[model samples]
Target: MRNFEKNIKNKAYAFQLDPMPDSFDKVMDALEKKKKRRFIFWLWILIPGFLIAGGGLLINQMYSSANAQVQAQSLKASHLLTVLFKENKQGLVHEDKYALTETTHTTTPENKMNNRPTSETQSLASKNNQPVFIKESSNQSAEFNNRNEKSFVQIEEKTNMTQVPSREKWTPIIFSNPYFVTFPTHSSNPVYSRTQIPFTKSTLPVIKSNSHQTGRWSIGIYSDLGVSKNIFINNKDSAGFGYTNARQLTDKFLFSYSAGIQFRYSPVKWLAIETGIGFTHYESNQLLSNAGFSWTTSGNNNDPDTALTLSSVDPQSAFGPYEYQNVYDYISIPIKVYYQKKWNWTGIEAGGGIIFDLPVNTHSYVADENSNMSYLRHEVKTSRLNVFGIQASANIHLVFHIKKFGLFAGPTFKYRMNSMFDKNYITRQHNYFIGGEMGLRYHF
Candidate 1:
């Protein structure tokens, strides 16, 4: 080895290394491999997100289409009524084996004074035709008599009647429902006597419509029922009872509940955003098996008259579980974005968002030192839970729309991405929840 080192040192000034272009290609190849891995990771995340969005949009479209169809049906009914009325005015000839006749005429003082034509009278009747209304002025009288389900109408007018003479050029009038209309607001007032009245055309329009439409806002409230899982991750760098293999993993989760009110607005058809206030309750029965307990006298050292009590806890291992329970309650505010789709009367919705949890209360547990080996009860202690934290969640739901009312139900998953405890605490805790939620909604 000494000979080789000496030979290399003696010839070092005379030797020169060559630079190969292949080395640059190797570095570039490594960079391309890293870029491909990054793209794959992003693709995994994007695939499910797009799927959820597509499903939600399809559901929303269905709901919108269903609502529109219902509206169209109602409009069709009204249009049918209008068409029937129009056909009657146009004197359509019916081929049915039924005869119908209607006669309406009015004579005003002005028309008589000006010698203008009074009115046009038309009638049709066949075998077994039903009797219909006949309206006339006070100067004239109408009598309709029915015998054996047969109808007869007679009108007596002082002036000579001018009837439609040609059936080919005649405009026949039919009345399914007949009644007198009150004088319009712009027309003259009623006589309030048994005198002949003239029909007046109103100058003011009725039932005018504009281009305005309803707003794109809605509100809903919901309550969710599901089980929540608890995860306690140990901080390996921390000293003493750091939650590393400290808990008996027998129990995984406990019952959890949440309820909230949401106010949403949609700027377009397929998308919406909502924000709301929520209340959540999380609990766990998972017991700590390696926790430590200690007792120490606490008092002012300078005062001889004061009494001291056992008041300290040691961060060590070896305490056993006895009647232990962990509970946390939080008030949350959530901001979420949704993708929606609809088909027929049903729709789908997918959403993701962040939750800001403000801790309202909790109960921490300590094992009882004097309990029997079989018992898992604990000594109740003050809580050491976090005051405020954050979480993320994704959810998918099926929605059913019934006019202005709706229903939603689906599964959701939540993860507390950050540790609840700060660096001051020995253990780090994260929570995972997988649950189903169902609720009702109202729309305007």
Candidate 2:
């Protein structure tokens, strides 16, 4: 029984049972009853408190910095304006001597009006005892009066000179921004008042004349996705394999692309001379002809009825599946004198030009299948250079203008005067072609 008690004591010690705090059981009971209440308490109290504090601190910092910057900028601008004002004041005082002289003259006029002694002077002149002294003083006063009159005339002349409009001031401001105008000073103002009558009192002239058309320059880059037909230009009587190949190589529905720059001169509102230099690339491929040899082997001796005969003959290559491609890249200089009839935001122009088409790179690639057993089964390719030619264009241009800039797009029917190929093989000349051009223009 003592051992059993000791064992129970050991178990109790292992567990170490202690009494709970006063609120621990109650808090545990509350937590177990509503798990969401604890989360709501923490989220509503701690989270919102932290966010509000952080946001307030950030806003305070930004407002402080912005206010400091604004204050500094305002101080700097005020200082600059003050300096400009002082400089202008000093310049006006130095340039107009009347500013100082007028102040003195105004004070003198006030003094003269207040100190009039005409009756006393007349009584002194009438007294016989002081007649000589009065006469001498009167003569002195008369001389002084004559001198004052001359001085008054001189001051009036100076005022008139100072009143003339200052070209230096107006010229600089006009050149800076001629579009805007500032109101002139009133005649009652103390500073620069007399000079305001000319520019302000006179009504500003109406700008009734139409805007003059200025010179224009434009450049355009375009990728054309169009079909073209490449027809053969050869001598009718050429008796060669090359002529036959050329005729067979011509194809329809080829690819073409062009790039150009156009310059325009506008002599009138609705008329201009448009000209440009441009480059064009035309490409096409076709199956022309194939040349090969054909031969048959002799019959074997196993059959007694077969007769042995030896036959020999010559053979020539014929037209078959030979691939060919022609690429014509030309530089064209076009001069077009056009008339533009302007509508609200668009214009139409129809013009023709004699374009000097300089053949830059004209190459025709020809390839034939190799059927020989000794060599690899590959196609044999050959390239040839071509001669240059001239082309003419008659186009109706449609212009879409936004302000003074415009986009010109038009369909042009082009005709070449000569074939863009070498004359040594096939000498026939192609006389015409058709294409279009789109460009951009800017007017000054």
Candidate 3:
């Protein structure tokens, strides 16, 4: 039995030393190739998924912007039509004029007592201080003579008396037939012609134009909420000693908020320039798989490199689920130009601009796998870290107008145009953000 076991052991040792068959080698190679192919397949799927989602978001934003413009224009047109109708309804209408005539016959007591035919004339003046002449017919005078009694006849012309020409010479005229006179009046008031009128008064209603149609200055308060991420660009020249071997850092989105006061100057109905200062809070969380040395100090000091040491020396300690939390507070100023289309009670606006970020404070911390805080560092010196900087952004907004006030809300996209860190830093940082902003605007 010992000899048989020895033989079996020898056989096993020989088998272990022998080379694998070609088919088995080919199968192993194929498995490795399949693994790579599966990885690439999944990568392709994920990339397109992200792209599709981003495209969908862009499409939605565009659709909403266009819809808002349409609605605003419709509202404006309706309001304009209503105003025009009201003005027309309140307009004044003029009426045409008609001529009038009057006749009168009178017998005075003196004329009757004289028992003799006598002709008497009386002169009268109108409110305009114009003299009027009245004449009696000769036939009436003959009748009075035949009766041996005195009589008088008066005929009044009531055509706009002011329109009648003023004659320096008086001429006598006869009318065989008796005539009646009628005077034209408006609401019991005598009407006068343009020649006699000293002044004219208007009785039309006054309509005020819409104030929103004119351009003006506006002031507003704005607030934003969003997600932000940082991208690191590695530089061999600026990467410090330990950072050369430092594992790649990965970051995730965190909450960001900003609030500010803005001033806008609109020179035309479609264009405006805006500027403002605001307070911003930005937070980001990063993960480092490898442990590294960080600069620290024993006491309160301004020196950035006064002390440097590794937290742990053991290689096992280097394999860590280390977490870094960064919080930055900034005072930001923005300059922008906007193009707007407004309707009666609404408007849509699009704008692009640069923002200047002035850092007020920066706080950084590290935590271990057990969620224990390892270090609290203020102003940790990192390569190429720009505490204050500038960035570019674009925005689209929908506005609801109420008299002199406007309420607005929109989506804003920001891109870092310059590196946030200096050239001496090992890693350069560029930050981008997507956010929603809301605000109230007052016009002057």
Candidate 4:
């Protein structure tokens, strides 16, 4: 019995080292196989990641181009409006009926021998009803000396000034109106210099305020890339199976991605409500080690009774380390409230929300010795995962406006509110997602 027990102990020891090959060439071969498997695993992740990133970039470029065009058109319309207003003021002033008049005074000397005002001066004085006066000066010539002769004479003179009407006729230039200015007509068309259209208050163009337009609706498309980790709680049962003198199985963060469409409505200048539906995919890589017990029986049917032996062996050590990959897919619906502050061309938005995560699929893969991978059957069903699967999220966005479109980028954080898996499972896990989100939105 002692020898049989020793043999069983030796066999258990040999099983521990069975997966590690003795030959250097065999080790290299195993390493090469691991490399191939790793390459394929990363390929699966990288291909779709690159595709989603590329698609997002393409859409952003298209939106930017369209936004730039719309901005240019808006600027053009503003400049045209300014020009139209200026031309309208000038035309009104030129057509004004008011005129300015000037008066002139002239004096002519009267002959002393025949001191009488001229008929032309008398006729002008009679029409104007003015009197003529004469003055004597010491420097007057004495040659015609009658001491009574006056040296200076003042005569009332009337000057007829004809008022000339402005020759530039105010022929209404219909082409210069705001309608034509805001929406320019083709230069090749016949230009109408005049129109019978009368100017009225209703026909005048209404100027829109420069304030930000609130109470508007907008639609957006967003994509995010990040890393996620599975946080296992209530893991005491599973922890017992860990390798000797080692901590329990732990998960590592892996790349994750999400894409979705959002709709937003603003009922006030600074507040908005938003909702969106999206697909979120999370992946985690884990190193799992466990201790397992097996029973061995010796002595064949010839013996009345067989000797039974029980042994404990590190399952990970016997079969090589286990590489576990957990993938979760969810269709998420989010409802959020936001507060936004806008500047002339930029805006800031802060929001928090609740998300309902409906499980679409769940998969777990385990890679063993020889780099062979197989799917593990899980008791937690995808349909049951939604029972407590909800998330709380918050984000702050920086938005730049170009015409009717906005470009936004921000950091987003999410915390799972409940266990992602059923609580009855041996290991219950939750997840946290943190990442940068970027997108483009069109405002109406």
Cα lDDT tens digits, model 2, 346-413, are 56888777777676776553221112111111221222233456666677777654434555666766
Which candidate has the highest lDDT of all? Answer: 3
Model 1 over residues 53-95: C-alpha lDDT tens digits?
A: 6645554334323432332332222211111122223333322
- Flag the better candidate by lDDT, 2 or 4: 4
> Which stretches in model 2 have alpha-carbon errors above 4 Å?
1-225, 235-250, 291-320, 365-387, 422-426, 431-433
The models' CA-based lDDT, in order, is 0.46, 0.38, 0.48, 0.47
Q: Which stretches of candidate 4 lie over 4 Å from their true place?
A: 1-215, 235-249, 289-318, 365-379
Residue-wise C-alpha lDDT for candidate 4, range 326-388, written one tens digit per residue: 678888888999899875345789998988888777764321111111112223354435453
Off by over 4 Å in 3: 1-215, 235-249, 288-319, 365-378, 381-387
Show the lowest summed lDDT stretch of 10 residues, model 3: 168-177
- Enumerate residue pairs that collide in model 4: none
Candidate 3 local lDDT, 1-444, one digit each (tens): 699999999898787555543557558876995796567546545543554455345433333223223323422232111101111233321122111112132333224333432254322222221212222322222111113232222232221111111122111111112222211211123322211111112211122212234337889998776778876555442332222222223466766778899999988767889999999888776443333343211122233332111232223334433444578788999999999987534578999899999877776432211111122223455432576688898989877654456677778888777766565443456778887777778888
- TM-score (all chains, Cα) for each model: 0.45, 0.40, 0.45, 0.47
